[model samples]
Structure formats: structure tokens, C-alpha cells
Target: MEGVSFPPLSRFAVCCGTHGNEMTGVYMYRHLQKQKVENITVTTILSNPRAVDACKRYIDIDLNRCFTNALLCTAITDSSPYELRRAQEIDAEVGPKGSDEAVDLLCDLHNTTSNMGLCVMYNSSDCVAMHIFKHLKSKITSVPVRAICSDEPISEGYALDSVGKHGLSLEVGPQPNGVVRADNFNVITEAFNHIIEWLQQFNSGATFEGGVEDVYKMTEKVDYPRDLNTNEITAAVHPQLQDNDFKLLRTGDPIFLSFDGETLRHKGRELYPFFVNECAYYEKKVAFILGEKVTVAFPSISVTKN
Candidate 1:
């Protein structure tokens, strides 16, 4: 079958299963399909078939990373025997030839390995993006959820980026075993329902604000500091790193005072250890931090406060 369409209305595309191990959305998609939602026509497309089978991030290439125009053309050509068939099936369901009626909305399901609460990854623009997200957050705040900036560096090559080029990315946090998973699933699914209901309610006079601008230009992905390899500490734990403390590392902070591993130093006068990926045991020690602003390895060295 090419596709199973409801009546003729705005398409609310719900894409799930982009990452293999983040299987919460896959189950939620199944649950959503079994139900009877009214108004907006919903189409749930399952990406990353190989990843889902292997239960790995991606098989050959990260499907999320391979959405560039050049790569999309190449991938459609290089499909394997099994993949070729599966690709065809998915195409039938949601290929380029699908409806072009100004697709009003898009939502993707995702889970994180880090137990970092729920958040929606959205393009800085899209007026309704924040509206719906805030609404969902208010409901889940008893559960307590936050919104991750789509322009933030962490969320790069995300399915949200692709769809947000057309729709929006709805990342529903990590699953706290089955209980939190159920709650997340219900809440997010209900959020989707509300989107449709809102669309129908405001169909007559829905006004979309222009893309988000002014503060900082939104980016496709966040830039990560590079060459922090070997034994260099970009930022370090002076004494004790708290929950939401921001540490700015200047010259001479005993980045690698002990000096066990090989250290990485910079060219300009300053020469202190830059520690990025240090040990295997330490989960997210120096890699990431939770605060207002984050420093990225980009054109400039330091990052301003958010």
C-alpha cells in the first residue's frame, strides 16, 4: 500500500525510532497508531531500520547525520538487498511524493542515555513550537521538564533539524524504567493530540511568527571543543563541581596537576592542560555541563554566559 491517509487536512507527521536504542518512541508510536485521534492527519515514519534491528546507534552511517542533500541522493542509490525493500516500504508511507499541503507540524520521539529530564528540541523559530512545548512542560513540571534550545550545540544532526526544516523535534527525555517511560509516552502523546486540536481550533486564523532571531542566531548544531584530546583540561573541577555551577578556566588551574596521562597544550602564550576525554570510568566529567551558557570549541575560545 502506498499510504493510509485519513481525510484531506493538514499533515501532522510523527517520526519515531530515529535512534535504535532509544526505543521509547517506537513503542509510543505503536500505541498512537492503535488509537483513534481526530482532526489533523498523522503520519508516523520510522527512520533507522538497521539501527533498530542491531539495537545500535546506526549500522553503517548515522542515519541522522546522513540527511545532507548529497548524502540523501547517495543513500537512496546504495541500498542493500534487504534495505532496498525496506526503504521502498518507508517511501510508500512517507516519500517525497507524499502530500504537500503546507505540512503544519512535525514531532520526533527521542530518549537520552543520561537521565536528564524531558525537553523539546525545536528550531528557534516556529511560534507554536514554544507554545506547545511550554504547555507540555507546565503539565510535566510536577514531573519537572525543561526545554533544550534547538540552537544549542548539543543537539546536532538531530532528526528535529531535518523535520524542523519542515516541522519540529519533540525529544521526550530519558525513560526512568517503565514507569517514567509510560508517563513520558502518555504526556507526549497527549501533547501531540493537543497540537492537532489547537490546529483545528485555530485553523481559521493561525498566525505564525517569523523564525527566532535577535539574541543569538540559531544553528543546525552546537560546536564542540576539539583537540582537548590526550592530557588537556579545557575546564576542570577545582574542588567540588556542584549541580549547576559554571566554572571558567583561566591559565594555571592545575588542570592536570597529577599529570598521569599525556597532556594537550595550546600554541598562544598560555600552556595549561586541556582535559576533554580523560578516563573511561568517568561518565560526563569534563565533556558537558549544565548551566545557563556553555563554552564551545568554535572560532572563539570562551563562551559568554547564556
Candidate 2:
């Protein structure tokens, strides 16, 4: 497929399909490519083609988890035809000298396995990212929740992390065939369109009302696992407490019991609740610990909107 182009702006980009199985964004991006945009131009990138074809997350490597200046150089220098071609495409948009004079924005689309609703993932450290996130939230209030921190630090070298650029990892649902895929698409499309309009205001030399806030700086990302299995293969979950207010349990408090068609037993030590349901049969992305409350965080927004 050919990359979509429009009237040249300072700079803009939309990258998706980092994971082959997570492809809702890919379909949406392809649809967008069929049309013509104005002022803000976009270059579309499909991170892992082999994985997408295999219906898996990756082929040789998790492309999303492999991003570094050295890696890019290696890919370009090692004479890997595919890597060289991919590098050229990427460099055309955000190369060392290409479009560096302008503000470059990347909107990454992704899907989740856990049953969390639609949410946007972004680095709050960047003001441009914050503005895009806030504007998207305002435009698509029904969906399109808060921006999230990436799982990159744990995965080591992530393309988004090493790029030294601003982007949003837009996670939109439970899975590829998740229930809210359509809603997720709408949220991201509306957000993109709204961003276009918001940027247009600046292009016309109009004063924008909202700016990045200090509160945005207060945002932090901490990863917690909803499912944890000991090396010995012991799996235990916290007991179903009186209410969802189960965070009152201390670290050493007694948790719950797992049965294998045997005697019932309670597990000692108060294990925190990343998620009440931690079954391997189900997808468990992450459990976010909020203020005095521990809920699923991977694909869900930190904030709740009425």
C-alpha cells in the first residue's frame, strides 16, 4: 500500500500495526490512506509485516520492543533488504535532518487482550503529547480515555522509546476481535480529525485556549502484573473480599485458594488484587494500582468519566 500524503505542515505521522495480531488500527489506517488530508501530512508504517501475515505478534522480533539508534543504523547498514527498505521509509518522515525543524507527532495504534475498554497511551513527559491527548479526550468524550505509559521499559528497547519523539500508543480494546473494536476505531478517528482541526487553528495563527498543565507533569507510569506465577508453578489469587474495597489487606494477609479437584484451602499472605479474575484462559495484560484502589490498568484509563 502507498503512504498517504496531503498538504505539507510543520510535521505529522501516524504509525500503527506494531503487533501483527493487533490490527484494528491497520485497517483503519488503510481506510484513511484512501482519502486525502490537508495541511498535515502523514506517513503510515506497518511495523511487523510477517507477524501480521502470520496472525501473530512478531516474526523475528517484537518490532515495537526493538527501537534504538544503533538498531536502526544496524538495520540500514547490515544490508537486510527488508530492514533497509523499512529504515528508508521511516527516515523519510522523521530522519535526522528530515522535518526536524518542525514538531513531529506520532500516533500509534494498538490492541489489548485483557477486557479493558478503549484508552490512549502517551508519554505525559512531552507537552505536545499532552495537548494531543487532552484534545482527543475532549473531542471523543464517549470513548477515547486517558493516555497510558508503554510497557517498553520492561521490554527493553522499544521503537517509541528510543525515537526521541512524541507519540501516543492508542490501545483500543480487549483483542483483535474484542467487543469494542468499532468504538475504539471511532475514538481514534475522531481524535485524529480533532487534532487536525486543533493544529489548523495554530496554522492560521490563532491563539489556542488550552495549553499543557503542571498537573500533566504529575503523571507517572508503574507496571503491575494482574497474573503472577512462581517459578515453582504455584498460582494463587487474592480472596474475594466483602466488596471491591479489598486493598485494605496488608502484604502478609491471607489471600485465596485454588483447587485441582482436591481439598479446599486458603492461601496465606495478603496478596494484592491486580485483578479479581486471573485465569490463563483469559487475557491478563496488567493490574494498575490507583490511590487505595487496585484495578486493571493495561488497557483502561486511569480516570473514570461520567
Q: Write the per-residue lDDT of candidate 2 for residues 36-143, one digit (tens) a residue.
A: 677766666675566667776655555664454455556454545443445445544454321344235666677765344455555534445555566666677674
Best candidate (score: TM-score)? 2
TM-score of 1: 0.59
Leading candidate by lDDT: 2
For each candidate in turn, the TM-score is: 0.59, 0.63
Off by over 4 Å in 1: 1-9, 79-102, 151-161, 164-166, 176-180, 204-286, 289-306
- lDDT of model 1, residue 233: 38
lDDT of 1 by residue, 1-306 (tens): 111112223566776676665667667667777876565677777766666767665565445544333333344444543433443444345533223432446676776534344556665434455555555654554344555544533223334334332445665544532223666677676667667665564443443232222111222121123335664433433232111112333343322212233333222222211222222113333433222332221111111122
* lDDT by candidate, in order shown: 0.45, 0.48
Measured by C-alpha RMSD in angstroms, how accurate is candidate 2?
Answer: 9.6
